[model samples]
Each structure stands twice: as structure tokens, then as C-alpha cells.
Target: MASPTTAPARDASREALTDSPPVDGARAPGRRARMPLRGHLRELRTRSLWVAVGLAVGALLGWALYDPLLALLTRPLHLAASTEHRDIALNFTALGAPLDIRLKVSLFLAVLVTCPWWLYQVWAFITPGLTARERRYAVGFLGAAVPLFLGGGALAWWVLPHAVNILASFAPEGTSQLVNAQDYLTFVMRLVLAFGVAFVAPVLLVALNLAGVVRHEPLARGWRWAVLAAFVFAAVMTPTPDALTMVLVAAPICALYFAALGVAVWHDRQVDVRV
Candidate 1:
């Protein structure tokens, strides 16, 4: 019923109204599209702050326990020397070696002590980005990882004294073993880290399976190869060229591999049901 000019103006008004954003002052549609990026950045900053705090706390604790920690770490060396009436003397080749060892030891202790808090912060930061199912899987993985890693570390601690004894036995019969402090610390740290990380292999496999990257059938089929690889890894990681040490490291990894296979199989079945 309107005239042509008036009709054009009315249509233009309607188009403008339709194009305008909502009046409620909530996020604009375009702005909402960017929310994820902004949220991710915010989370990154928060996680960084938390990680810094955890590291600081760890450093302080490390400093406080430095002496006792050093003693505990060196107990294996002392025990190894008990039977031979020889002392394990630590020599510093470099003038700054003592200070350097202290600093390195402090950092190492800090990382070990703060691992739980650091891991939790990382998990918390990434949790919001994961699906509910993924979050559940992550929680389970972390729960299992903590104990598995700690058990591995404990095993290393137990076997270390024996390993030290075995290695020290090879020293010339009448000579006192003079071990470099830095070298001894480095050796122990390596063993602890190797075993601890090896125990987490199952968790990694399970996570891959849950993410649908790998399924159980392939893992089962490759079981032989996996066993061989685990032994090879153990051989490489063992500080001493001893068969027993290799077996000790390999056995646990092999067990973890089989466990991972079971988890992967279970996950595959769940995925099939959902599909």
C-alpha cells in the first residue's frame, strides 16, 4: 500500500534493523568467535604464573633440605664402601665444581619435589580445552602416573645401592674409590629419571588410544617388537653395563606395555559401542 520511494525507505530500515547487533550488550556474534583465543591466552598466562610459583616453592624447599638430601643421595656410595674398609671420596676437578654441583642439585631437587604441583597446574590449564570424556581420561592417567613414577623411583633407589656395590667391586682391590661428586650425582639422577619416565609409557599409549590415534589390535600384533624395543631401551638407559640392571629396567617397561595393550583394547571396545 506504500508509495515506491517510501517502500524502499521502509525496506532499508528493516534491513538495517536486522543487521544491527542485539541490544542486550552481550558479546557480539563476531566477538564470540574470538572468545576461544582470548580465553586460551588468559589460561596460558594463569598457568605460567602458577608454574612459576611452584618452581619458587620447590627451590626454597630444595635449599632447606639440601644437606639431608645430599646425604641420602650419597648413602649408596657409603654403603658400597663399607665392606672394603675404603671410603668413597668425592674429588672436585674444577675450582667451581662444588658450587656448580650444589646449584645443579638444588635445581634437580626442586623439579622432583614440585613435580606434583607442576603437573597439576598443567592439567588444570589444559582441562578446559578437553572434552568431558578426555578430562576423565586425563585424571585417570595422572592418578596412575604419579604412583607408577614414584614406584619406579623407589625401585631405582633400592637397586642403586646394589648397583653401586657391583660397580665398585670392579675397582682395584686395594685402592679407595675416589668418585667425583658431580659424576656420582649425575649417574644417580639419570637412573631415577630413566626409570620414572619408562613407567609412564603405558599412560602415553593409553592416551593415544583414547584419542583414537592407536588401537589395541596393532599393539597386540606388535607385542614381540614392543618387548624387544623395551629391552633395547633398558640396555641403553642402564648406567652400568650389567645384564641385571637391564633386566630390572626392562621388566617393568614390558609389564607397562602389556597393561597399555589392555587399556587400548578396552578403549577400542568403548569406541565401537559409541559408534
Candidate 2:
């Protein structure tokens, strides 16, 4: 019923209404402007708060499980005592040492238990800058890293008793070991943490290769150094007098490094093909 000119004007008005800029001032429907520094700080603050909350809750759980955890950690000392036929005591010189060690162990357990959550938070914070392919790589990195680290920690536990036995054997015919509780705890933690971190180091190499930060050829060429480093690391971490225990620890690390190297070579080839 309207005139042609009036119909055209109506269409124009509708088009204007539909195509007008958003009230929020977004340039396009699905696009957003870069967040300001304050926004990023706020986001970081929120994520950090959640991480702290997770740690606190995990620490509570660790406290509840402290008895079993302590028992497990001290098993190496017990084994050493039995095998060496000597008195091995973990002495606490300070009155507050017990409470301090408990708190420290609980915190360590909390960090281990809540690692996946905190790692995801870290990944999430950096994800905006990554492409989809990079995101997939990140996910795979997390999945592989966590298990490898845990496995390495388990291996360290298995190796502990032998290392303890060997070291304890070095004592004179009648001397008993009076180890400080804090010192022993620190040693155990460092050994376990070192093994875990060492296992994860290969995964980092793969990540670097994926990011094109390092080439596979260099890794291949450095095989001898890798072997040497693996032995040196085993020597430092395990402190065994014989080659057998050191080899047992070093073998897995060497295998993992070569495995990671293979992965890098394969990935580099694929990238070459794609290019």
C-alpha cells in the first residue's frame, strides 16, 4: 500500500538499524579490541587468586594425608637401617622443626597435587596469543609432561633405597647415622624433584622443536653430550659408588632424550613437507 519511494526509505531505515555500530563500539560482530593493561592485570589477579585457593585446599588434604606420606618418605631410612644393621635416627634439634617440616611437606604435596590446575591456568593466560595449532600442542605438552614427571618421581622413589643402602655402607664399622630431619627431608625432596624435572626436560626439547626454536640436527649432533650430561646428572643426583645404579638411573634419561630427538626430527620433516 505504500508508495515506491516510501518503501525504499523504509528499507534504508531497516538497513541502517541492522548495520549500525554496536553500542559497545565493537568494530565487527565477533571481533574485540585489545584489552587494556588494567584488564590484563585484573585477569592475572583472578587467575592467581584461584591458584592460591587451589593450593590452600590441596595443602589441607596433604595435611590430612601427612602420616602416610611421612611413612613412605622415611621408608628409605628404615631400609638403610635394616640393611646396614645400624641405628639410623632422624634428629630434630629445634623444638619447631617438626611443625616446620610438616608445613613444608604439606606445601610441597599441595604443589604436586594442584600442578595440573595451575598449569592449565598458566596455559589459559597465554592462550590468547597462540594459534589453534599451538593450542593443540599446548594441550599435548601438558598431557605428556604431567605423566612423565610423575613417572620420574616414582622411579626416584624406587632408586632411593638402593642409593641409601650404598651410601650407608660407606660408614665405618660401628658408626650409626644421626641424620638431621630437615637435612634428610631436603635431600629426599631435591632428589625426587631433580628426577622429575630431568624427565620433563626432554618434553621441553620437543616443545622447543615444535616452536622452531631449535633444530633437530643440533640435537642429533649433541648426542654424545646428552649421554655425558645424563651420566653426570645421575652421579650428582643418585650418588652411587658403582656404575650399576648410576646406569639404571641414567639409561631412562638417555632413552627419553633420544626419543624426544626422534620426535623432533619427524616433526621437522613434516614441517618441511608442508612448506
Top-TM-score structure, candidate number: 2
User: lDDT tens string, model 1, 1-275?
Assistant: 76789988988999887667644423333432345877778877988999888888888788778889888988888888896567776778899997888788888888878889889889877754555566667789889999998888887787788778777878887788789888898898988877788888788888888878988988999999999998887666554666888887789889999999988888799889999
User: Per-residue lDDT tens digits of candidate 2, residues 103-157?
Assistant: 9889999999999888878886777656556667888998988999999999888
Question: Model 2: what TM-score?
Answer: 0.84
Indicate the TM-score of model 1.
0.78
Off by over 4 Å in 2: 1-33
- For all predicted structures, in order, the TM-scores are 0.78, 0.84
Worst 10 residues of 2 by lDDT: 24-33
